[model samples]
Structure formats: structure tokens, C-alpha cells
Target: MFSLADLPDTIPIFPLPGALLLPRARLPLHIFEPRYLAMLDDCLKTQHRLIGMVQPQEGSAMSAGRLHGIGCAGRVTQFSETEDGRYMITLTGISRFRFSRDVTGFSPYVKAEVSWPDFQRDLGGEEEDPDFDREVFLKLLSRYFEVAGLETDWSNLEEADDELLINSLSMLCPFAVEEKQALLEAPQLVDRRQTLTALMDFTCRGGSSAPDELLQ
Candidate 1:
């Protein structure tokens, strides 16, 4: 239940590739690396318990690669420490942020200053895709799933609400990293649905997985 005012100007960032966390969606992460473990420990002591989930882009000389410009900030809602000393946590997406610049520091993990003005809607409650056509979308999804050799419970997807179904699919779908980023950057629920549908359709048509071609 974090309001816009509760969000911080800076937060610890976890730059994971192909991990897409949209607003109001939930992302479960396993923290095993020493730096991230330390990051999690520090986050626990804070009131907001927020972490920026960003994706690392390719073609970077740095070991962690260059981070994407935009990322979603999620609050640690559920947390548990495993017997092996790893941290398992579920981050409920609070909002998407525009990455300003990295804050150089002694901290092992990356930290950055972020702004949320561009995505004020992310702090709002669940959104409805009024234009969503479930049956058609599902049919397209079935074909895409079949082509991709993926399986799922049709009943569960059908039962989910508009936001849940779209966000879940956008997160779980085996699309390319940049495609996932495009979905994350989509301006609205309807726009996300269209982007997702286009990606699936492109894949179904035996298109290349290259992000440039897929998005174009």
C-alpha cells in the first residue's frame, strides 16, 4: 500500500536480464549472490523495502552490462531466508521508474536515482483493458503457445481478470529480452495487450526472435 509519496528518490537496483516486473505484478526472486544478499538485508531495515528491478542490456564491456533506461520498482512483500542462507522474496510491483544515473558508492550492488513522473499511473490500482477480447486473444495465445511448445492451464487463464491475464502472460511468455522490455515500457494496459499480441503473432508466423524486427 505504498503511495507515490512513499517512494524514495534512490534505491538499490537488481539488474537482471529478461526479468520483467510490471506495475501491480508480483516477481519472486532468489538472492544467492553476496552483494544481493547484502542488498536484501539492508532493504529489510528500511521502511519502504523497495528494490529497482532493471534489465541489463547486451554489448557492454562491464561485467553486469549496461542497464536499460527504464525499470520497475517493487516492494518486498513476502520474505523468507532459506536454510542454505539464501533469501527468497516476492516483490509486488509499485511503479515503473526512469533511470537517471547510477550512484557510485562502496555498495557492492548498483544504486541509482530514479524518477516516477512518466509513470504516475503505475501507483494507481489495477487497470482494466476495456478493449480486450479474451476469446480472440486466447485463441491467438493457444496458437503461440503451441508453436513455442509451452503448456498451461487454460481454465486458470480464462478465469483470471483482464489485468491478471495480460500481465501474467507478459511476464511468463518466452519472448526476447527487448520484447519484454517493450511490454514493460508500454504506456497502458491496452497498449501492452497490443504489443504482446503482436509479438505472439510474429512468433507464430515463424518470424525471427531478433527484437528489432519483432518490434518493428
Candidate 2:
């Protein structure tokens, strides 16, 4: 368990448009772009190894896009360099933070001042949501996979805890940027489970709509 007091005052940020991460979840990122390669190099050198996983606001460009207030900070738990000079890394979530402000001349990638007060609970790990219905989730997931021509290891899905299942489903789903953000912003486990359930249903039925519709 990571302590909030150990959290940094500043960290490097990755402004991927549709990528989302949740606390205790693992996000695997391939560092190929020059800018991100530079960023990874810096992280390896300094050993800070913490990157903020955030989405660019909807309808915005990466260079000039506004970020949603919330994002998760992850630690580089796995790393390997390839012959092509590319780095493959896995970041395991440490905690969620809200965007406070940005500063210049920090690093090649974007940097931001972030606060974790709103999501301190995430540090405690995933809480069980009694109101959450796992059967419903599996039913919808089965239907969506069938429709999408996807397959799963039923045993693993059955053994996964609430947090793992929700984050895995949320991360793997081909939902839009806003939908991903909604999963990131859910106040707690039950809310995320509920939101994810709706999204799964919509996908199973081949329905598409805005994030707000699914949340509602």
C-alpha cells in the first residue's frame, strides 16, 4: 500500500486521448514516439517512474486539449528495452489525483500539479459494493463478447475480484473517450460497476450514445 504522504508534489503526465486507468489496475504502454521515449528515459534516470494517466478532454487536440480534472498516477512496475530503442512498460496504479494546474519547463512530456484529497479512498484498495450485481455484469459481458466476436477465459473472469473485473472490462472495452473518463470518475466501486454495466449493455445491443447517457 502506498502512502499519501509519499505522493509527489509534481509528476510527468501522459495525455492520451482515450486511455484510462484506475487505482490497483495495470496499464501497459508502448513507448515509441520520440517525446514519450524521452519521457521514459527521464523516468528511468531519475527513478521517479511515476506517470499520470489522463485523457484529453473530448473534442480537443493533444497539444492544446484540456484535461479532465481527474487522473490516476501509476508507478513503473515493469520495464524492458527493445533493440529498436523502444521501451515497453507496465504502470500499476498508485492513486487517483485531480488536476490542479500545469507548469512549463518541467519535462518533454506535460507536467502538472495535482491533488489527491478527492480520491484518497483509492489508496485503500477496491471496496466491495453490496449493491453491485455480478451476475448481471457477466450476462451483459457474455452478450457483448458474442456480438463483438471476442472470447474470454471464463475461469479467470469468474475468479476476478470486483476491482480487477471492473477495471479490466473498463480498460479493454472500445468505449469512447468520454465513456472511459466516466469510469475513471466514478466515486467508488458500485458507481463504476453500475456505469460499466450500462456501457456493456449498450455495447451488446450495438447502441452508441454519449457518456452522460450511460451515467444517467
Candidate 3:
């Protein structure tokens, strides 16, 4: 329930690779690392309880590396602490942000100054993709799944709404880190769908030989 005016200029960030959190989508995280566990503790102490989910650039060490320019900020909606000193939480995406600059601090986790103007539309309700061709996309998805040796409940996919279906696939698909960043930075639902379709098509056409091979 955060308005644009309510978001802070600085927030703690979690730089994870191959993880995507779209607006209104939920992401579950396991917080075990000492630093991240400290991050969870700090987040719970704040009113917004927002955490920025970003990706480290490809070919860079995950512990210390440059991050992608765009990322989503999620609010900690569900949280629980296990007996073994670990934290489990679910983040519901709030808005997408553009990275400004890293905020140097004594904290163990990374913090960044971010701006949210470009993705103001993300603050709205679920988006629509009227031009999405569900039948064709499903056919491609089925073929892609077969080639990748993955399985899913077609009935569930068929019943999902456009936003749910597309966002979930964009998040869950085993795309490369850069590809996931592309999906995260895509301007709109239609754009993401096209990007996703192209990626699946690429994978279906024996494009998996190189892990670094990206969609053109």
C-alpha cells in the first residue's frame, strides 16, 4: 500500500542472478546467509518493508559484481523465522526501479539509491496484452518444454490470465541471467511476451548449445 510519494530514495537490495520479480508477482526467498539474514531483520524494522531485487551482471562473481540497471522493489508481505535462525519470506512486487548509485555504508548488504519514474505504470493494476495469441504461444511453449525436458500442467496454464501466465513463465523459465534481466527491463507486457516467445523459439531451435547465446 505504498504510493509513489511513500517510497524512499534509498532501499536495501538483494542482488540475485536469474531471479525475476514482476509487478504484483510474488517471490519467495530463503534467507540464510548472515548478511541477508541481517537484511531481513533490518527490513522488518521498517514500515514499508521493501527490498530491491536485482541481478548481478553475467560473468561476474555473485558476491561482488555490477548489477543490472533495472530491478523490481517488493514489499515483504509474508515472513516467518525458523527455529534454526533462518528466515523465510515472500515478497510481493511493488514497482520497478532504475538504479542510481550504490550507497556506501557499514551494513553488510548492498544498498542503492533508485528512481521509479520510468515504470510508473507498474504502480497500476494488472496489465493486459490484447494482442497475445494464446494458442500459438501455447504451442510454442509446449514445444519448448518438450525440448527442454520440462513438464507442467497445461490446464493450469490455459486457465491463467494473461498477466499471470506471462509473468509467471517469464519468472519460472530457465533462461540465462542476461535473458532474465532483459525480461525485467522490458517496457511492457507485450514486449515481455514477445521477448519471451523469441527466447523460447531460440531454445526450441537448438540454441542451447551455448549458455551465453542470447536472442537477437
Candidate 1, residues 8-112, lDDT tens digits: the string is: 999999988778899989999999999999999999999999999987775443233588899999999999999999988999999999999888889998889
Could you give candidate 2's per-residue lDDT for residues 56-174 as a string of tens digits? 88788775258888899999999999998998899998888988888688466788899988888988956787876778778888998887788989899989987798888888888
Pairs with steric clashes in candidate 3: none
Point to the candidate with the largest lDDT. 3
- The Cα error of candidate 2 at residue 154, in Å, is 1.7
Better of 2 and 3 by lDDT: 3
* TM match of model 2 to true structure: 0.92
RMSD to native for every prediction?
Answer: 1.7, 1.8, 2.0
Residue 135 shift from truth in candidate 1, angstroms: 0.3
Tell how far residue 70 is off in model 1, in angstroms.
0.5
In model 3, which runs have C-alpha deviations exceeding 4 angstroms? 209-216
Which portions of model 2 show Cα errors greater than 4 Å?
Answer: 210-216
Model 1, 198: alpha-carbon shift in Å? 0.3
Cα misplacement distance, residue 62 of candidate 3 (Å): 2.4
Candidate 3: TM-score? 0.95
